[model samples]
Target: MEKETDSSEMFIDPVCLMKVDSGNKNLMFTHQTRTYYFCAESCRKRFAGNPDKYLSNKSPKRKGLWGRYLDRLNKTTGGKSLNCH
Candidate 1:
């Protein structure tokens, strides 16, 4: 039997960086002692195609509305701060 992995902890999908409940082992895959969860099959497939890309620590910043607004302000300053001025 597959050793039951801890399901209570939540983790972000390496592919999308979206939070996921790790307890749902049915929706997860393991690689190099790390667990990855997927909110969709497409995301899972994308991760499988090139796990290294998604697993990298240098993940692209998420393009949420707030992030975009902050990025615009930081574009000239080269900072990630939230200060608009």
Candidate 2:
């Protein structure tokens, strides 16, 4: 069972910055009394795992898996460029 969505109403998914329909009942989560919509279940899970991470106004922008891996690689190499023969 799903609610009827007003096509005019849209919400931004905090985790992925994707537009979600306001009436998306399945992919919604409530935190601190506020309801949020997500583009997918994975985004919902990520938000549920750490709501504050998405809610904090001063937190660093969230990155994708490849971005995170690149950041970690940079840290491991002290920001040195990796050269392959």
Candidate 3:
């Protein structure tokens, strides 16, 4: 027997592990700090207009396991990893 997988599972963001909302997957990308989930391109645009306000919780200097991993990976991969940005 084969296991069934949901299509929604493919849209989940790996860093946040949250299902992408129905409409705006195309507007997705990881910025310097956090993983943003938008409902539309306009919403993402709005976010870009003042990213600092929305991304206050995602400081680049904030230290954690993920931060350390990104630092090491950045050095090894020459910053090729998408997650590093």
Candidate 4:
């Protein structure tokens, strides 16, 4: 469970919630302060089209309830994290 030391090995594709080999640097992107991997370029583009939607629906480990609440605030506050996390 301790994958912090090796993110690529533990990488998970947010769009599909599928495990992805960290070595697939060609199919990944970073947003905010997180890295996301995709099985295909199409997935990447879809995510980029509406990241917040995908992010808001993300796993709790990615953004706790409080963090998500803060995210909503950002939408109304000119897209800036409240730094509440």
Please report, as a residue range, the 10-residue window in candidate 2 with the lowest summed lDDT. 57-66
Evaluate all candidate structures by whole-model CA lDDT and list the values in order: 0.75, 0.86, 0.60, 0.77
> If both were scored by lDDT, which would come out higher, candidate 2 or candidate 3?
2
- Clashing residue pairs, candidate 4? none
Q: Model 2's lDDT to the true fold? A: 0.86
Q: What TM-score does candidate 3 get on C-alpha atoms?
A: 0.35
Per-residue CA lDDT of model 3 for 1-85, tens digit only, reads: 7644443543543343345653454866567765566655666676677766655545667765678888998999898866644
Total backbone collisions for each predicted model? 1, 0, 0, 0
Model 2 Cα lDDT, one tens digit per residue, 1-85: 7756665799999998888887768999999898999999999999999988877743557676678899999999999988876
- Segments of candidate 1 deviating more than 4 angstroms: 1-6, 57-71, 75-85
* lDDT at 54, model 1: 69
Q: Estimate each model's TM-score.
A: 0.59, 0.59, 0.35, 0.55
Q: CA RMSD for every model?
A: 5.7, 6.4, 13.2, 12.1
For candidate 4, give the lDDT of residue 36: 85
Which candidate would rank higher by lDDT, 2 or 4?
2
| Cand. 1 Cα-lDDT | 0.75
- Model 2, residue pairs in steric clash: none
Candidate 1 C-alpha lDDT tens digits along 56-80: 6454664655677777888966875
